[model samples]
Target: MAAPLSPIVALVRAADPDRFLATLFAPAAQREALFALTGFNHELARAREAASNPMAALIRLQWWRDAVEEARDGRPPRRHEVAEPLHAAIRAGLLDAADLLAMADAREAETAEEGIPSAGAFTAYLRGTAGGWSVAAGRALGVRGEALALLQRLGAAYGLGGVLRGVGRLAARGRCLLPADALAGAGLSMEAVIADPRAAAPLMRAMAEEGAARLAEARAEARRMLPRSAIAAALPAVLAAGDLRRAGDPLVVPGPRGLAARASVIMAGLRGRV
Candidate 1:
């Protein structure tokens, strides 16, 4: 039998299964670094729920920021599941500290009470978090030059699909990441979106349309330039098409995950096309 999963890997599998599956297709040696990067993202992603107040949340993020710097400086890492392996990867030169730090920096914006201010701001958030994560993973996989840049754009497109898909769940948590202008155009506030998901349908549809266009552009570009070495890094985009399609309908409940999701991932992996 295969070795049992590591704690960090298990955590990622449960929290971000899509990325977890994508990571599995990586070269065995690089999978650990990918998981460490993803696990770090998962930890940062939960900062809001991990702390009782905004200050505490910021402190938590700062703790991560310090951890990244420590990793880059060749110092002992704070003893945590994700931090340990993440620092190990950094020490091995399999990951870049700058890309990891960019992921953390973008998340600090999530602590704000107000939703995203504009479409441009929303895109920037996607660029930093998703784009940074992708390029970091791509670099770790031996991708460089224009391919690394393509990974960043593809990651942003994937993020757009994800943001649209999770709008309903986010609204339930009293958090809305929709562009303020879109919300205003729909006459909806974060509170309003939470109260009436249907009221936010128009905004969701608009976001879906945007995601489709971005994904199309990214996919065409990827076909021309994304390196095959970065297949694992880019594989997460395989699900973006289905996500964008469903995103326009907020009331549509997501079906359970089963064989189909895995099968699609497998096909994408074999084809080296995300």
Candidate 2:
């Protein structure tokens, strides 16, 4: 029988993921758990957009939704391939199955939608997936109430940053995420902006700058309110998302320079030397 994937192995399968997680977390145990969580997230993300056929991708996403549900109810998973590692992370981190299910729900909704209409809808969609996921991770690390809220806020910032960065690739998928109203006000349409990649650059710069500012605020809050021990606990989650600001575009596969920078930042935090 083939060996189950170690956390590093699964995480390292994707460049950004490996760099981000490896740099931010170093406790062999926590790293393993995080690797499992991020690996599953990356899988779900790809299943939604990687394949040529949208119908097939939708089916695959549905299968994931079902697996999340089954795992939540303590039923043996229907899809072992994705379920096993995810289950391991849940156990290791005290992760709630509900948050994972919520992620699937967000993807299911996005897959069915024709396209994002405005920034509000995009924010709502991100809240369900990225925001939910970060809150869950914070909870796993034992953050509560206010701290949890802050984490969710940071996650939202990360999601918005990703959308801006990935505008080019996202437009290629027959979906556009820029707030149509916002773009209209800016005298742009999703099509026009994407068609002329340079046209989108200004908005992308604005979004990235805004996201970085929000993240900086969140990090400051964490440093103040969170216990020192837990600061390290929170560091990786924030830094992994923060690195996106420097990763060029979220949707385009990150290159070696971006990946290497991500790894360095995380490793510094992991060593308690950042």
Residue clash pairs of candidate 2: 23-266, 23-267, 24-266
Model 1 accuracy (lDDT, Cα): 0.83
Pairs of colliding residues, candidate 1 = none
- Provide the RMSD of all predictions against the true structure, rounded to 1 decimal: 1.6, 4.1
Model 1, residue 237: C-alpha shift (Å): 0.8
Candidate 2, TM-score vs. the true structure?
Answer: 0.78
Q: Candidate 2 residues 173-265, lDDT tens each?
A: 656667666677668786776566456666666656766777778777766675433333344444545545654453464344366556655
Q: What is the total number of backbone clashes in candidate 2?
A: 3
> Top model by TM-score, which number?
1
Q: Which candidate leads the pack in lDDT? A: 1
**Residue by residue across 1-274, what tens digits does model 1's lDDT show?**
9999898899889988888989988899999999999999888888976888778989999999999899999999889989999999999999999988889888876777776788788888888877878899999999989888788888887788777777777777777788887788788777887787778887788787878888888888887787676798888777777777778766566665568767887898888886
